[model samples]
Target chain A: MSIFFSLFAGLGLFFIGIRLVSNNLRQVIGRRLRQLIARAVTGAGSLALFGLLAGAVMQSVNAVIHVLVSLVTAGAMDRKRAFPIIRWANIGTSLLVLVAAIDLHALALCLVGLTGIAYYQQIDQSTRWRHAVGALLGLGLLFLGTDFIKSGAALLRTEPWLRLHISELGLWLLPSFAIGAAVAWVAQSSTTVVVITMSLAAGGLISWNGGTMLVMGAGLGSAVSAWNLAGRLQGSARQLVLFQVLLRLQGLLLTFIFYACNRWLLDDPFNRLLDHFQLGLPARFAAFYMVVQLLSDLGSRTLEKPSLRWLEAWAAPSLQENLSKPHFVHDEALDEAETALLLADKEQQRLLACLPAYLDALRQDAPAALASADKRQAAESQVLQLCEQFLVELADRQRSRDVLERSMVLRDRNRLLGSLQESLAELHQSTRAVMSDPTVAQLLDHLVQSLHIVLETLAETAALAQPDAEELELLRSLTHDRSDLMDSIRRRLQGSDLEPGLRQAVFSATTVFERCVWLARRYVLLLDGPAASPDHPK
Target chain B: MSFEHDINDEQGTRLVSLKGRIDSATASAFEQATQDLFATPNARALLDFSAVDYISSAGLRVVLMAAKRAKQAQGRLLLCGMRQHVREVFEISGFLQIIDSVADRSEGLRQLNA
Candidate 1:
């Protein structure tokens, strides 16, 4: 009963210690972590070292994984570049077990006291220093938790029934492996399981071979937990999680092969080597962890191509899968202002790309073209509405004045596009209505030709990021030309004899055409106007 | 479309009845017939548009041009008997403020002569 109590308390403290340390450390490092990741991609070695350093400070591999996943999702870092960070982070996470193996309770306690004193003196006014104090306290709690786990294992060693149960089942290795995996999965931290394994090994409660098999299972358990944590993610983010699982599986395979070799040989080569270094059970346990990590890293580099091919086969479709779906507004990206803004820009471009096709559909005189135009309008309308909702959510999340202004500008542009679409539909309806009158039909045919030119120019100018001098001049000329032609048609209509309703339909068609030109001009100004200004160059 | 005009002789007042749409198709005809009326020096011309169902920007443009010509000829151009839709067009184009509109031809004649 005492053994169960100690073990439960130890596990509880372990969970709290890890959470406190990682959360506070993350708070201290906040934006700097993102900046470090940005700079870390300069070289493969730097990226690996960055992962190691970050994991060591963050003290939780899951936190490092989240940051890497976010960077990949935001398109800041390629998935290929992100693999090294994940690989090294697993290695960095093993470092805590090594540190905990040593008796650092006294030193950690002293550091905790000093930080507490500093905190009480109000020396930690800045959030960073306060986080530093919290981190030191977490370190103290971790050391204390290690002590409790060691004491708990020692208590369990005295229980004859528990000893018999473990000793009777363990030599097979598979049962121990399964038990270790179950514990690590529940704890969500293989490092904690490893620390517990070390305690049992040091207490002479478990054999070195048994400890190694358990560690292998812990590795697999960490991978499973990582998969669970990233379950909601898709595309490259989920791909990274799969790669992480593959990395752990490789480590398990290496450890299993090494265990098999050691079991086959009468000499017991690995244990003999441990004895040669004058290492104890604790040191050997940590060495096993370090060895598996090194072997996995090597395996990753050698099997990079096949591993990537395999992962790609299992990868989800990218955000650009369907034009009607929301592409740029990823939920994961909303956490970062820059990434969200960039995604919004991409969505705007996607919607703009649909404009030319819609106009072409409108101008087509065939029955099939009209049907296609309706379909295109429906898709474009759905996409535009989704994009508007996305932009509004993005703006609500972001506090920057620049982001707000950009979102507003984008909203305005989208609104204008929507109005233009409505006008085109109205024009289509009125144009057909007046077509039944012979005199008006003749005029409508001439107007359609002129209107097509204006629509073509609008579609062309809208697609450009910035209209050149000639294109701008051409747009102005075309807009002026359409206006003049509409005026002349209006004057001609005044002289022709027609029914009142038919005349009204033609007049409305002309009005709709004028509005279309106005919208086209507004679209040009939105894309190139302020950005091209001297104070805000493109 | 269809347009009907009735010119009534009164002291310093003339009421012309217009029916149907005064749009691009009929604006010129409406202007051509009303041109001589406004050309009468210091004569007040009241255009009753109660029967007119619609008016377009082109019709508004012509009306504005007639107003300017009327003012230049030292005559007044008055509008009356406009339907709701026609009044909305004038209101939307901001022509309502520029052109004088009344409840009926009598009110238009009263304002023009006054």
Candidate 2:
């Protein structure tokens, strides 16, 4: 009973430590980590190094993949750039399993002592070092947990009842592998399972061959966990998860082949090679885990292209994702400042064309909106942001004053477009909210129709190569101030016998409409150029 | 809802009278009814909305599209005989300022003829 208690306590401490370290360390690194990921993709090599670094810090490839998925979704890092990093992170996660091979009882004591003092001295409450302190405490707990697990396994090995069962279990390779896979799936971390297996092997509770099967099974189990974790993810995010799963399967297959050769034909060359290092059973198992990860990484590299194609077919990007990506701006265009600016303008024009789709849900005559307003809005915002980044890059590279001035104007217009999209989305929601009210149905219908016309006109005018002065004047008139009309609607609502929620909806809808009109006018003035609008400040 | 329309040409002006509800279900026919009003260059037309009790956003969209086509063709379009509810729809949308309208058919015809 005491032995079972010790094992359970050790596992509890280990999981708690992992959770503490992963969650807080990310907070400690924060935006600098994200900035590094966004800006440092010079090539595959740098991406792999960063991926390895991320895996080592987080100690779980699953956690690292989650971070990469978010970055990909946000357009901060391309999925193609993230692929190599994910492959290498699998190897990097072996760092913890390797570290666990060596006994660190003294080091664990020192860490516990130091962090205890820090906690007593209130250092953990210091904002600057709080996460760092927590991470150190987690490291100490992790080491202590390792010590407890090793001692518990050593005690359990002396039991004749356990010895009889384990020896019988080790004789059947499939059972050993099945046990490891089941435990790993439950733990959601193969490293945890492998480390526990190492303790059992060192204590003479399991054979080296059994440990090898367990390690391979743990890899497969972790892959399953990743797939389950990514159940809600879509597009390239799902592709990354599939990539990770394939990488694990590839490693498992290679390791099984090597195991078969060693067991049947080759006079145990695999174990013989590990025997050359003079490592104990625990270190040997750790070495075996590392070799499997390395084999997976190497196998994945040779098959990377075809594997990516397969993943793409399996999880093709959704329409929203394709829409969100910038179609015109590319990094190669940045070398030629004028071309880059032109491409940015073209992308902005595309975004403008998408604006009227926000009201498609409210339009009875139109086909169903391509996506929900929020999703479409987010997609447009993503493209607008990319265009802004391209323009900023152009400005930085060009020393010519004329180029810089034009870039600045484009940036201003990009901001106005963002504001316009936001207002239109809000108006859509508010109008929808009141559309069912019998008293205000006609009013809501009119608002939707009027806004739709202005949006379509604005989009059309902006698409022209050089919008004539007459067309520009027409846009200006169409988007001119309608504050009086909105105010009259509000006053009528205030005096009407309507429910408070419906009344507020009407007021909110009118206010957003007014803002949408103002934003459209500002955009038109920007389109007309600063010289043409003396009354509006640049 | 149900909608019906009648189109007549008086001299150079085209007059259309609409009845029933102009909504999503009937907006297509409403649009089809006025398609030929601007077939000729600089055409003049009047739409009477007294018999129409309700106009939904879809119906308004068809009306807005017709007005834009008329402007593009360099033609004149006038709306008249709008019931109280229909006129409120126009006024609230700010379309009253962009498209010309009047209280009754006689005024709309006089304006178009003059």
**Per-model lDDT:** 0.67, 0.78
**Which ten-residue region of model 1 chain A has the weakest summed lDDT?**
A529-538
Against the native complex, each candidate's DockQ, computed on alpha carbons, is: 0.02, 0.34
Report the lDDT tens digits of candidate 2 across residue range A86-160. Answer: 887887778878877445678778988999999999999999888888877877776676566656655666778
Best by the TM-score measure: 2
What TM-score, to 2 decimals, does candidate 2 have?
0.79
* Model 1 error, position A196 (Å): 1.4
Best DockQ goes to which candidate? 2
For B1-114, candidate 2 gives per-residue lDDT tens digits of 589999998767999999998877898999999888888889999999989988866677677778877988899999999988788767755567678999999999999999
**Which parts of model 2 are misplaced by more than 4 Å?**
A1-39, A95-168, A186-188, A261-287, A298-310, A313-324, A329-332, A382-399, A428-431, A530-538, B1-7, B16-40, B50-73
Candidate 1: global Cα-lDDT? 0.67
lDDT of 2 at A359: 83
> Which residue pairs collide in model 2, if any?
none
